[model samples]
Target chain A: MDLRVEFAGLVLKNPIITASGTFGFGLEFSSFGDLKRLGGIVVKGLSLKPREGNAMPRIVETPCGMLNAIGIQNPGVEAFLKDKLPLLPWRETAIIANLYACSVEEFGDLAGVLSGEEGVAALEVNVSCPNVTHGGAAFGQDPAQITKATEAVKKRCGNKPVIVKLSPNVTDIAVCARAAEAGGADALSLINTLLGMAVDIKTRKPVLANVVGGLSGPAIKPVALRCVYQACRAVGIPVVGIGGIASAEDALEFITVGATAVEVGTANFLRPDQSFRIIDDLPRAMLKARAADMAELRGSLVLPGQ
Target chain B: MVVRNCREVKVQSVRFLGTWDEASDFVELTLENPGWESYRPGQFAMLRPKHWGLELPWGRPFSISRLDAETLTVFFQVIGRGTSRLARLNPGDEVVVWGPLGNGFSAPPETPTLLLAGGMGIAPFRGYIENHPTPEFLRLFFAHRVPLANYPYLAMAEKVRAEAMQEHTPEDLPRIIERIRELMDENHGGIALACGPTPFMRTIQEHAVAGGLRAELSLEKSMACGVGACLGCVCKNGEGKHVQVCARGPVFQADAVQL
Candidate 1:
């Protein structure tokens, strides 16, 4: 059972990439499993300058999920390149940098900073983070801004494949996917957490200090699959499915629905070794799904009345 | 700086040793040790029942109340949906346990140490008292809203010089605060270690900082991953920068964190 997946100018040993934010710098989880075993590692969201993020009580647990307003707290791209990136096993696995910025030019500047590093295999443009006040879901919710941000990163990102991660908060996700495609994104990953909120009825206050946050985990799997399905049909570029992917079967569900690969997010918190477990289980899962390889299963969803 | 124990953190599926009500809502649970390195006082673990489904996605974090060669113990109150579910588990059930996590409470053996516990805040002191090299140098001052019998006061009282005070109302806080100040004065240059609700810990922090007394606080925050990766359980340090409680500490020095 070959789990290799080739998409967006990168060939992964498997379709199991740890999503940004949840997996930290990839060094934190080194004790749980071998990092080289995974297909890719999308590190924590990085910016041109270090971000302090939201105030305390930034995350709250929801039903079978969690809402987080981390605001992309990171040590900036320079710190990552100097202090963190050299320590990662990027030679064995794809180290995709997830870029977060408040402006289009800043996104390009961040991409340019990372694109020169041989360790960085790709740049994931995060215009869909719902936790921040600016340049997050604001840019993702608008198709024009999505095009502009994607184009700016593409222009400065040298030869590194640019993946536009789309938000699910918008009314029409397919339109956003098409907008990224129009701006020359090599691939698309959807959906970056749904906009949600939780309140403490006793105190009559919001659970998260940020008031609203992005919801992730098993609760959002169906929504992520729907968004990925629609986006895959709407765009010519390959789609990488993310959201609530905890097991090999969950990853296959995304692959079956037209996604070339899948990224495990919140489940990384549930079980630290979840991504490695999924990769180990994929061969058996492929056997159970009656597919010899990912290519045979990719986009194999049978529509109604087919 | 507190000397931290170097231990390998691992996740294991261990057998549940059942749970019992310690006092009213307070419950104590035991589990078979998962064969990791021995943990120190104030270290914690993330626990989730193996049978749990999507209804409860993440594991709950608890301080290690006691640990022996065969099993480990944790104390928690039924405050929310997670603990209520945890209180009903049967023996022989499998549970996913991770850690011996975070920096635990630490002080030199010869130094006189004041252990201030607020209600359920007494959980970690059991391990601390049991492991302390010189028990004569430790003093425990416990303050609670509930009856003194509702906590592990009597058991801890036998081991060290212990005192209990009841705060029946907000007005009673001054008496408790006065008692804590007296204890700090008695211990003089000794260090104060506290664990409790935010208000209780805050009071300790304020008084400890003001009187020039050295202190360490065990903070409680809702955490997703017991590791620092989630960045969910961060508290501001004295520098006003957010530091992860799960990684940097659940136990922080008096002046280190803003409280």
Candidate 2:
């Protein structure tokens, strides 16, 4: 009753889950905030092997968003399989394994390995990570490729739900949404970081060593709301909206716009306790919105005349 | 027993302590919060210079150079965007400030002390000179490389020496060992405190151990969550257990660290 949210196949206890890349794994932040209380956790971006990632200056600050080119620097799947997951104080929280690859086979191979493994409740077919150079943004940018990766993993995953993470970097996000939906994605999380960059004036250099990076924060709030609103209308599946979510009000904005759920990204870095803060504030937010239940708040927004 | 609130600060001033060619900017900050009770010489604070709407602050772990009750001094090399933007900051700009957290160098009851820092690592040494300066019980050895131009506070090295019978050496640096040995001889039984890259700290720790001197070291790690949840900032200790450099330390007893 306190913090639960319902998705297609899962009944999440709270809507306050740690977004991928930012939370690292459940092991470290457990000391700061109880990971068990989270709706779930999306661990670091994993491919087949551990990645050293880009050179120095992997992260930079924009006006309100951050440009990070860590290029998904994770200790590949095997290392994560061995080192990171076992340590989480997971309890009942859903542990979502986020997988990425340049080729369809790599996604399939990686998904095949994780499908039967312990502790993973779902597989987030990640074709939308904007930071890396190769397969990530490429596959995510094209709807055809989005379907290709989704179908590949769907063939490998037996009972697990494959939630495709969609990129807002595209011209038409719903085009990519339909592709994932068509390819049998059980669910979708929209609006990954919008690609962006900031430059230094006196020196005349681009801020990130990678030249450009994903932008996330309060600045992107409206864009995220618009994207989620449209995607929810287009898709036949649940949509988890993410972008510039900093407060309970910000989260409710996503839910009202038709997002079945929402993922808080850049805000978690500002305050480690932010997720819990949102959890505490959600019920009051529901009360303020005058919704009897969380689901009633979903799609509560109306157009000018509708 | 305590709840620390995160505060956003603005950059009031950013300037090279010496010359522009040095690429070092000592950023002065003013935030909504006044600050924590007097910080230690080697303590560091994490900062997010206004812009990077990131949920997390991306400030590098830097030592507190100088602090008046209202502001904190953060010295950084203008290597990347964070520092370059920080360099552009004039008075009245704002940033998100969190810290004065982590283990600071122990200056226990002023038994006797030797302070060493390299390059921009000279930050915390200035704090020690200002805050922990004691007359007879503690002695200091402040050394850095050439072009002691912008850093006028090297003068503080001499001031600490006047009372503690200290030795001041600003060497071209093949003489770094010679200068340190000379100071150690004059001030035996002194506790050695150091900060720099791992190798620099390792060299100082070895020298201190070889001479049977006491020492403390500050460590650095790549961190996103400075308060320790990310586990991104992990460093191997002597026991081979990976410890959170942010929560477990930025400061550790010299010999206890594996490095």
Candidate 3:
């Protein structure tokens, strides 16, 4: 009853991969569990130039969730390619690097650099950073911007598979998902951290230095499930369901909703070995759900008419 | 990560051992863990209020206040969010505890020691004096407003008794050196160890040099990776050499660290 999954053309051993922002370049967790044991390790978002990120207080804990406005701090694409890439000891897992940009050209430039990298299995093009303050956060909110951003990345990526990460801040996520597919996205990952805030009541100010941040936790589970349900139906490519997937029962929910693969974010910070815990729980969840195999549960989200 | 269960924890009761005004919410918790019989100076522990949701790691670092080899005590000022949350908890509550990490103070047993403390910098000195009791040799305990006469608990033993040495801010380096020279003139040679803020440490080191006293100064700085990977807590020493406060020395030789 164990769930097996494939993302784009890459076959993952399991469906539980740690999400990007939460997992710091995949090396830190090597102490508790073997890196090759789980599915994949999504590296943090990279850009054409290095970034110091937002000021201090980048993260704060709200009721049942966390708001992080880290602003995608990374050591640029050239440095990542030179310094971080060669250090990865990938045996049974895939290394998916997430790319971000303030403009289409920067996104395209990042994709171009990753496309030639030998160890990278795929590219997760990030169109949804919230802390940018200006037009930078616009790409993932509108369908047109999503399509334009995805197309720009796809054009430069050549044969590289692009997974367009969509934000939940939008009104309707399906429209945004369709645009990503139309612009040549190979796959999709849903519900980047939901935007939320925690205020210091006494101080009459926000807890995080950044006034608001992307929220991720068990608190955002229902919204994330709904987003994954919508995006899976809107696009033909694989949907890697993310957001609030901590336990095996949580992973099974995304699998039943038509997610070919799933990512464990925020939970990674809480428990570095959460990928293994979720992966360990999946087989028993499948047995309890009485599912035959991963194929049958892949698209169990059929409509009434269908 | 290796699970070492707590044996007999002494002093189950916690008392607010300092000025408890709401404006400055600092608490010195006396956890009654008789089993906590072993702890080194300069080491810290992370404890959370009992049943606090695991939203954040229950473990936040706190400097040890007093160690009786049976009962472990710690002192912390409520500064930001975590400590504020901790201030709300009461006695008879159990916070998840993970502890005794990183290198502690090198409090070599009383081979003639000179102890210098500033403000709350006196926290770790309690343990050092208890462990290394040297009365015959001269020792100096520098306090802001004569904390010894106020606290009175430290100088109770002859093996560790020391005279109060007061040095006002920035201007009285010469007077401070004269006091140190008078002490060294009498006893076996001792190492000068001071713990205070950056500016306070600089003055102590300067005065120690004028008196020709070999000194070591402990520092307090903002830190993220206390174990030395993040490079977040780097401070430049006199030689322009950068040192990690968490890993290298919360305690540094006065002459070694320019500040």
Candidate number achieving the greatest DockQ relative to the actual structure: 1
Worst 10-residue lDDT window, candidate 1 chain A: A128-137
lDDT of 1 at B9: 28
Residue-by-residue lDDT tens digits, candidate 2, A169-264: 788988999999999999999788888887889789986668887777777889988988889989989988888888888888888888877787
User: Which prediction has the highest TM-score against the true structure?
Assistant: 1
Q: Which stretches of candidate 3 lie over 4 Å from their true place?
A: A129-137, A301-306, B1-59, B62-259
Candidate 3, residue B192: Cα displacement in angstroms equals 8.9
Query: After superposition on all CA atoms, what RMSD does each candidate show versus the true structure?
Result: 3.4, 6.7, 6.6
lDDT per model, in order? 0.87, 0.72, 0.69
DockQ, per model, reads 0.44, 0.21, 0.14
TM-scores of the models, in the order given: 0.94, 0.72, 0.70
Candidate scoring better on TM-score of 1 and 2: 1
Greater-lDDT candidate between 1 and 2 = 1
Kindly report, for each predicted structure in the order presented, the TM-score of its chain A compared with the true chain A.
Answer: 0.97, 0.95, 0.94
Instruction: Give the higher-DockQ candidate: 2 or 3.
Output: 2
lDDT of 3 at B164: 58
lDDT of 3 by residue, A141-175 (tens): 87877788898888888677889999989999999
Clashes in each model (backbone N, CA, C under 3 Å)? 0, 22, 12
Clashing pairs in 1: none
